[model samples]
Target: MSINYLVLVAYLVVTFLVCGIPFGKIIARARGVDIQKVGSGNIGTTNVAREIGKGAAALTLLLDAGKGALATGLALWFFPAFITGGVSVAPHGDAAGLEGLVTLAAICGHIFSPFLHFHGGKGIAVGVGTLLGFAWPVGLMELAIFLVIAVASKRVSAGSVTVAAILGPVFALIYGPNLGLDLLLELAGLVVVWAHRSNIKKLINGQEKEFSFHKRGDKPEPDDDTIGESK
Candidate 1:
């Protein structure tokens, strides 16, 4: 293998490590709690906000999203060097294809983090970060969709699944004619949907918990234990 190929391999390894950092765990520890033993036993923003506080949740969101953005940014910064090697793995000049691979890798690393014993967040925040890295327009569109749905429905899962379900078509429409890139995005979407299978069941059964901005003094719901456990 050429030096460029070696560089590509190294880039992917670094991306995984960056994306796998358990920001939720770190933030929870700072708050004197173990995220894994808290609300929903999840390390995502929703659970953090519920079990810890909004400040910590916001910080976790930023850090988790940063992982994906940093991974994609690094790939974009270094991928050009590999392209000069005359490699035909991805179509010539198809930067979107390279971005798609990097995005998928980051998402997978976040969802199945090695640092967390192969458990991690649901990938929504990281997905947004990756999409932003791929193209700011796409990322903004997705974020808008997520916010509107989440706010209107008061259900994070509803917004999350809806966005994941449509990412493939939206991506294809925005950047079409790139079969490899489209397929990678579609596969990533599928993985995200699969990760939310439990949420889907709850949605069907009307047992899914809705997000609340204000803390409630009432007892936690029975389903709280499993609400964000999919991560």
Candidate 2:
């Protein structure tokens, strides 16, 4: 009925479509198979990288990040900014407690995309983008932590889990208590860690695979396609 209500509803719908439908279609058509059927049975970019080539996986990653950014942007636009005193500020709407509703909607859309029969990615990048949209400081902190872990472990899951753990209290502190953002982060962190449970087991067993981005001793030059195939 009210402008805020209409905008809030539109925001949720748009985020779901952006994070769920488009991402599912991209994974399906880009790789000629639904990502849900691939490694780990999850549609996240990490699984995409393992199943499809790096190129397609990169595309999915970018798209996922874009959806989070788009959702937060829409939420901000809908909430509007008003000048209070000498500074411009976001005026709380009736849905003030729904601060990160757009972020959650986007993440949920990615985690259980309708297009993928309610199965999708583990929500690492989507969460990163959501935090980035909410607060750049916390987002950068999480990003730095992820990069450090990824480099050390060479495991995307390791980095993702670590980042999620770091985000919970970080966002809570930044946004203050009594805000809805902490609840969303807490739930999202749980989901992300739960999704990586298998990876954690593998890590404990020391059987976890590492990403290979190096030249092997037997690898041939780029021009030697014939030899490369045999190698």
Candidate 3:
């Protein structure tokens, strides 16, 4: 095989391995807890914050986001030579089609982690990181939107879903149309939304739980009737 193809394969392997490391599990182990058995049975930052300490949750978010950023950065370094000459460039932009593919792969690895029995986090943190890889403006705007909605609704799921729902259009408007990036973001957003399907049902039934920053031990468990209502 050609060197470019070899590099591409190597990139995919490394990105998947790095992104699928399951930082939540590592943090939970350090705290003597199994994150997968905790709130929402998710390994995402929100669940970590609910079950473990906020410090652990913050660390997990940063690590997960870092995975995406690192993967995309590597792709940008190695994949530029692979971009076809005929590919359309966004205004004043270089070839980033491969970056989109790398971002998608990183997000997929986080969401469907091979190390976690193919079940993983909701991908919000990594998605933000991937956008950051694309451009600081895109990442900052999405992060701002997420913060606003999350604070207003008091639900991380709500903020996550809302930002994901609008990511494609917003990216298109801000960065100009790059069909590869647009399609990748659309797929990534849908996957994120699907990951929160249970949360959506809870919201529709007026039963979704608001986020709490308190440590898990600080709060008593909700009764069975209220269980499974929080993420």
Candidate 4:
């Protein structure tokens, strides 16, 4: 058996399990409540953040992101030749590009993980981390966009959706084709956008809740009508 085949297999196995098992367990344990039961009913970091608090939420975010990076990094470490292919007639033929593919696989596993019954988070943190591992410049851009939108709208959903949208073409333009990283990034972006459709509707109707970073214990404000009617 060629080392290349082993490397590819390792990438697949690592990426799939990282998002599917460890993430689910960590998130579930941290919240002390089944993440699938709350908020958006998906066991992703966002719901966990809203339910648990910042510390746990941040942990979830970092773990989710880290796993993507870890999976890619491991593949690089274990199967250098397989990933790089080292100056071959075939295209892409490099460790960096192979690492990107691992990143994408991890993102997909995070978003639409089969172990979670196809229910998963929006993939913002994981996607960003994956990009950061594979392409640092693109990752920085993603963070910038996320921060800009998050501040401007005061909604985490808004920022997450925007970052996902930018990932597609940005990677393509940066790395170009033959690597297939762009297509993977685009697909991951699409999944994230789809996941946030409910949030999009809420934003359009002016019903989306803004995040309060400073007030850790603050809850979302009640509807104005309820308050006015009470008065």
Candidate 5:
């Protein structure tokens, strides 16, 4: 398969820009709140939920996830993959690798967004959305693992890292022997785990705060343990 370098680069750049949008920060700004100065100072869903209201957080999540899904869907549409009766997928060599790279670009856009001067969110929602757009079964798998761990431990980062690290095997199982594409997708997951490094450390040290919703009245929860913690 001959590669279209020009089109590939253009697609990646577009995906990066689109997925890089900091909806969390934008929503906060609309509500007269600076998400960057609140909670963990991250322009992600967690920070929005913790600092702003649930409505704003939901909007941010929806937008962030939408961009990622759109990017991934475009990739699969452009670099069509080989599916066996809509059950199993086989690699299309160059096209498969390109699809993985495109999906990776989507997550990278959120983690190191050019719009935010290379600073951005932890990439959880976008990563899931990207995978969901790529292979919904795999996406659901990751989402299930994330929800289980998150709910069990009350720490979102734990769920994020677990899903990110496990994608290698997940791809290996579902994508067959497409080592190159599998590895490429694993790179996408690695970028997500990298974004959650601080949270990883906090978790290891038992200092990570549990995911909690802020009051709608804009008042802090009296028992909010995250009030003093910077995370």
Candidate 6:
């Protein structure tokens, strides 16, 4: 096997380990709260802000997103992109496809964390991190989309779903000609949506929690329904 294979394997393992660190749960526990037992039982930024303080929540968001960004960054640092003259760039071959897989690995590590016994966050913050890993242009676009929808709906889950659902295609458009990578990103997006299935159902049924923009806690008492996005 090529040295690239070994490097890829190493990147995957490291990414999984780092991204699996649940910053929200750890931060909440420091404040005498089991994040998983709160309104949504989710260890994402949203739940942290609700149960603890926005400060803790901010830390969670930064760390969660950081782990992912770190993982993806390391991989790309070792791997090269397929550059195009005009503007397009990224994989169109084996290394490129592997890069996509490595990016996916980052998200999977966060979602199916080994430390949490294969349970983890819904992939919003980490997803943002990976997009940024791919390229700032792609990452910024995703951030804008999440913010627009989230602000308009007053629900983080809404923004998360919309951005995740479209991640693969939009990413493909920007850096495609690599079908394998495109499909992997699409699947990653699907995984994000699946994680948010409950929240989506709640949104359709008028049960999802909307932000009160208050200090802590919100209206409807914030059911165990899920409240997180944009780490």
TM-score of every candidate relative to the true structure: 0.89, 0.75, 0.87, 0.78, 0.87, 0.85
Best by TM-score: 1
TM-score, candidate number 4: 0.78
- Model 4, span 1-231: residue lDDT tens: 677677577768668767654464366566456655544555566556665566767777788888776765566456655444353312144334555567667766776766766556667777787777656778888888899999998898899888887776776666556445566667678777877787787888999877743135554222232111100
In candidate 1, the residue pairs with backbone N, CA or C atoms under 3 Å apart (3 or more residues apart, or in different chains) clash, namely none
Per-model CA lDDT versus the true structure: 0.77, 0.64, 0.77, 0.65, 0.78, 0.76
What's model 3's lDDT at 212? 81
Give the runs in model 1 whose Cα sits over 4 Å from its true position.
85-95, 213-230
Best by lDDT: 5
lDDT, model 4: 0.65
Candidate 2 residue lDDT tens string, 172-225: 566555355566667777776775667777788896668642132322112211
Residue 127 shift from truth in candidate 1, angstroms: 0.8
**Candidate 4 wrong stretches, greater than 4 Å:** 1-3, 22-25, 28-31, 83-97, 173-179, 213-231
- Candidate 1, RMSD to the unseen true structure: 3.0
Question: What are the RMSD figures for all models against the true structure?
Answer: 3.0, 8.0, 3.4, 6.5, 4.8, 4.6
User: Residue 42 error for model 1, in Å?
Assistant: 1.0
In candidate 5, where is summed lDDT lowest over 10 consecutive residues?
A: 222-231
Candidate 2: Cα lDDT at 229? 13
Candidate 5 or 4, higher lDDT: 5
- How well is each residue in 1-231 modelled by candidate 3, as lDDT tens digits? 877668777888788778888998798779877777656677788877877878998999999998888887656655656656654333225545566667678878888888987778888999899778657688899999999999999999899999888877888888788777777777888888887888888899888889986454564232233223222
- How well is each residue in 24-63 modelled by candidate 1, as lDDT tens digits? 9898898677878766776788877877777888999999
Model 2, C-alpha of 79: deviation from truth (Å): 2.0
The candidates, ranked best first by lDDT, are: 5, 3, 1, 6, 4, 2
Q: Which ten residues in a row have the lowest lDDT in candidate 4?
A: 222-231
Model 5 vs. true fold: TM: 0.87
Looking at model 2, residue 225 earns an lDDT score of 14
